[model samples]
Target: MAKGMMIVDGQRVNFDGEKNVLSVIRKAGIEMPTFCYYSDLSVYGACRMCVVEDEKTGKIDASCSMEPRDGMRISTNSARLLKHRRVILELLLASHNCNCTTCEKSGHCRLQELAQQFGVRRIRFPDTREHYEIDSSSPAVLRDPNKCILCGDCVRVCEEMQGMGILNFAYRGSNLQVMPAFDRKLAETKCVSCGQCAAVCTTGAITVKNQIGEAWRAIHDPSKRVVIQIAPAVRVAVGEAFGFPAGENVLDRLVTALKLMGVDEVYDTTFGADFTTIAESEEFLERLKNGGPFPMFTSCCPAWVKYLENENPKYLKNISTCKSPMEMVGAIFRDKYAAKDAVDGRTTYHIAIMPCTAKKMEAARPEFIHDGRPDVDLVLTTHEVIDMMQETGIQLGELELESPDLPFGLGSGAAVIYGTSGGVAEAVVRHCLPDKSKNALREISILGLRGDAPIKEASVTIGDTELKLAVVNGLANAKKLLKEIDEGKKFYHLIEVMTCQGGCVGGAGQPYGLKKSKEKRGDGLHLSDNAAMFKRAERNPVVAQMMAEYGEERCHELLHVSYTNK
Candidate 1:
């Protein structure tokens, strides 16, 4: 961290002046209004609301993209700045239909905040009222270009965060809107449906295919059993729904809240991940022994799996045959556990709490069907969970500890961290090694990936063998890895790919509000992982307990699942 002397509002302050102005300004308790400026991604400086006048340069520049220098005097709130800001926003409003009263993001829109900040009273530019159509074609997300500010935030996040690069600027000028490859609808493209775009949109241009109301309907319906399975990455970010900051553990409260919402049974997907590791590790060793695919890719991320299938089908054989933890857990609860427990019932409604939107597509995949019913019945984003709680009058502080149901209930720390990038591989390495020693597990922390750049790569030795692994957190980066693998440039024994950046921490399901940027809740998951007693897949007492009661034969035959190129 380098030092720089910056004068803001006539007060001199010491700033870590190496990077952009947004970094230093926020550090000094000053809010620099912005769009097109995300800390997790690069500063495009497109929305000039962060414009500040420099004493030395005599030119106003976007604080987000500017490099602070020593002795630089910056004016963040001058009349000149406001005028320019309002003009930029007003011109923006002309081509866009905000419909704030009805918009889901009305209270939390960055564009709306900027409008009020600049005191833009009237639409100076014609409404053109020239309407643009909304594309609700994607099962996971909907794109309303009519409300898009064209800040390129979605495009940038898709490119810099997820690395999917799906939302590229198409055509030119007035006709230029974010369009996917070949201008196809999102459903038809290599979109992956991670919904990072929806998370980044300042307006309600993009949103998850909301199913909270549907969930509520089921919860109230006596006929349907609304069983909820919480994903590992969800524990890290779901706290934000209840006003908990990033990194704060609210599992107890969350569980209580879900129980209040009328879920018949609340389970953690970590158990699924735990089961997944058992199956995957066994499969990994099998691959090594039989000399199968050199790289056994993790199939836990449906988005990544879809990318491989659609973009690089040649390497399909390299993918691990294990089903995603969510689906795997779903299959057991619906088919295996139902039969074993002798719970003769009608159609089972299984709902999964996930950090990625692509999961909706994954759940809908006809291939996921097991014994006539789909493995996963429904998928809800993190944001949707918060809505469900609010709708059901579930208070955050009043939540109590309600134990998750048995059979596929218990999970280890290894299972919890699967929400984060590199977590799955780390869990596999910890439990999958031939000699699962505590010393080896304690000494190694396989968490890789760096600096919000999306993908991370690292290697470690397991017993007599050194294992090479890659974790692609961003969807765009997943594309890059698939390309690298297809091109025969990079090689690894295993790869874990999550569709969202920062793993599930930056998931589309997380809460959102105005104020330019939202305080992230990422710690809840990490803290839960660190404090959990069981941390390995091989030795999770709950999974072991289940196996003992049901027999290893039963666990292997039903608890685990398989995948293919299709």
Candidate 2:
């Protein structure tokens, strides 16, 4: 591929290291529609929606599969290309279930958007595809095969990004469908419930399970004391649905919206992250003193924790016993409300607004249950919360700014960065360092801990001990690092593994966004960190007070949890 000019729709465009004609055309400012083309995944060339006419050869082929050349001339939207794209969309719509009025992904679906863009008013062909049963067996995701267009985005994302081939194409031709092996339910397979498949799905074929009805019911119940906690990543991304720019923090406006929607109390999940940071750092120190289980992997990500339980159980002991920030906070709220319940007779209905679908699964785990009730009664994704606001006829921009409830509302700067990749490692470093000065915090911030990289390594010396740390996002990258450690090719004292790329900011439950959007979200979290009054977890007076009130035994009981190999 040479750096030279090429003609795209009669305009000369320069191509330098662009892998495909689609990239070159996009670079030249053409919004070429694509269903099977994703920059982060391998080119499949299945949909043929990005086909372009080669002026010289008068032939049309998928631009996504063709390489950019020095003197290539192509027409992106010629009359013939338009016809082809329209027909392609029509054929897809013929087989797809067109019940958009009630579809979960009605407004945001790429298939619906493309069909409308191409003016597919009526499907030319009759619907001949058999209806398939919707699979809602999984706690985190739902599968509706009838809406599938065979784009294979979910299949590729699960296999390539997560290194989990739990989804794949089965059968052939008209009967073809994407599903787990032997047609098993997702919950029955070794699926970790990361929901990356749902993240990349073009239609409602795969989607995060909806809990909005249950959430609304809980809020309306007079006997229920509804409580909600918003995750750090959510504040940065939720504003995108309401016309705010990506990475803009709208926590105050969101608080107002939730309050208007009858939420009794609202808090920040970062307060829980603060507790996790302090407790995890203490656990790391204990491991260092014992001189064993060298690499203590972080356990805040339920997807990563489930991956280890499913795929590699031998190393379970190496994982930190500390519960995730969401769980820790849920447990605390449960305890606080249970005491209040004894007097007022109002049951606590705890809800978590998170950026990850796996949080749904995490909340349902038996380990987090006390007596017969789960700590977190419900888990809603960022998208779900947005839907709730919209359903309530509430406009976020119109709401007056409001603050979260006291006690669990405030969090340290270190806890705020837990939304992005390497943030957990950086927060732990901030805790381990004896120096709490501004200079120390600045140096820690620049220790290659912030980026879109899949894996980041750093070394720090704290109190006569040198610690090597690795922060890994994407389960595939984590798997690669684990293999290296197994082969004696690498070593580390602490490893922070986030299942989704770019950490929780790129979680499957977030608004559909690619690499750049995730970067913006990460930047927003760092900005929040810089604006915080307290930098370290230890400096949070509320957390310190809670620690003293709970004592060592109660803290261990609430904040720590052990995982099994199953």
Candidate 3:
């Protein structure tokens, strides 16, 4: 990554010089309408909607595909460019479905908005009127081929971002549809049910198999005790569902809203994050002492675990035996928290607010059930939870703040950082290295890996062992790194790979406004991370209380978990 200069529309700019024309334009506060040019993943020039006029060449070029030169004059919204783009849209609508009024994605669909914005009132050519069937067989999502724009956003998201080749272009040109091999149902295919596809889809082609209605039914039930554990990531993302800014930690509001919606025992998943880190650090030391696997892979991400099960089952032995923070925390409440009578032990139900749709499937996995009951009974994405809160008449801006309940309540900054990339690996090192007599001290800036990046690398020393760390938020980067590791090219002691790009901060469950910033929203989680008296996990008072209550060795049994391949 080196610095260089590039000229865009007569404005001199400093760039890595390798970015595409669209990237350069965006860097200059100029937005180019595009269908297939997603910022987090690689470019796929399937849609010609981003066509722009090049002054020097006098040619209309797709800004996403064109590379910026030293002096390239480009007009992103020129008259000729708009005309050409509109014509392209007209042709697409003629062959495709354009029933925006009746479409499920009428308000949110990118294609629908673009059509209205461009004033594409009618299809110029004779309507092809093609009909396609929707596949609703998947466990966590549904696919409607009729709504697909063939922009390859879903395919690229699944293939590149999730590292799952469960989707591909089936048939050529006019008959092309994104589907699993041989048109098999997604549930039957090697689909990990990650919902990364739904995250990028511009149309209603894909969406989560939501069970919020069931939650509402249970909430209205007089006998059922509905309890919820809010994940760390969900707190930062829920605001987006109701037009709240992205990355805004609205946990206090979220808890208040959940309670308003008739939810009992509003718990924090950070309790589980702290508990997980404690066990993970111990697991690392045990593997280091015993002659077990050399490089331990994290298994908290169900999507990543599912990807490994489908693509690289042989490497399953390397995955750390630790349940996801949300799952682990829910289990504790169901087993331990209930015994203390937080809620009626017999009927209390566990609900989880997460920044992931994959969590829906994760909760349903047979393994997640123990003692004839699933650890989590219901899973709500950030979007669904926010919707629930709004429906119950809770004012998000005015909800009185309440601190988390004890007995797996208080959380530290390390738990807060779990919502970001590399936070898991960094937290583990902070908690474990000090006990191992590592010379390195805790540092908040883990090589600038906290924010959004394709791939971030760092190194640290634990006693004599020089631990190499790589944090990948995007699955595309994970695929590249895994290829290198599979080929026996490089060695890393630990790898923290999140399913969503930028970690859960950019999760699928997030609302549209996640593209915005946190400073403007003004939440306590964001402020707590900055002003924490002790930032690390090992120093957290609550975690120390847990260790004191149950001897440190007892953590391995209470919090630790293992994964299986195939």
Off by over 4 Å in 1: 1-4, 15-17, 56-58, 121-124, 336-346, 434-437, 446-457, 479-490, 513-523, 545-566
Candidate 2: lDDT of 399?
Answer: 83
**Number of clashes recorded per candidate:** 13, 0, 1
Positional deviation of 232 in candidate 3, in angstroms?
1.2
Model 3 residue 26 distance off true place after TM-score fit, in angstroms: 4.5
Descending-lDDT candidate ranking = 2, 1, 3
lDDT per residue (tens digit) for residues 62-148 in model 2: 999999888899999999999999999999989999999999999999999998888889877998999999999999999999999
lDDT of 1 by residue, 1-566 (tens): 56768888887778763577777888788888888877767778887878899877779888887787788888888888878888888998888886888787777788888788767878878877456678888988988888887788888877776666788888776777777877688877777777778887898888878877777777787767778898876665666556666556666677778877677778888888888988888888888678768788888878777777776787788888777888778767765546633564544578998877888888988767766677787899877887777767777866776667775678888888777666777788777655556676665563353223456777777667777878777766777777787688998888877776666666676665321212233345556767887778766877766657777677666655455554
C-alpha RMSD of each candidate structure in angstroms: 3.3, 0.8, 4.0
Which number leads on TM-score?
2
Residue-wise C-alpha lDDT for candidate 3, range 455-554, written one tens digit per residue: 8778877778777778887666788888898789977878888887667766777664333342222233445566655666677777677668877556
TM-score of each candidate?
A: 0.90, 0.99, 0.86
Which ten contiguous residues of candidate 2 have the minimum total lDDT?
115-124
**Which runs of model 3 end up more than 4 angstroms from their true locations?**
1-18, 23-30, 54-58, 68-80, 94-104, 122-127, 241-244, 337-346, 392-394, 435-451, 513-527, 538-558
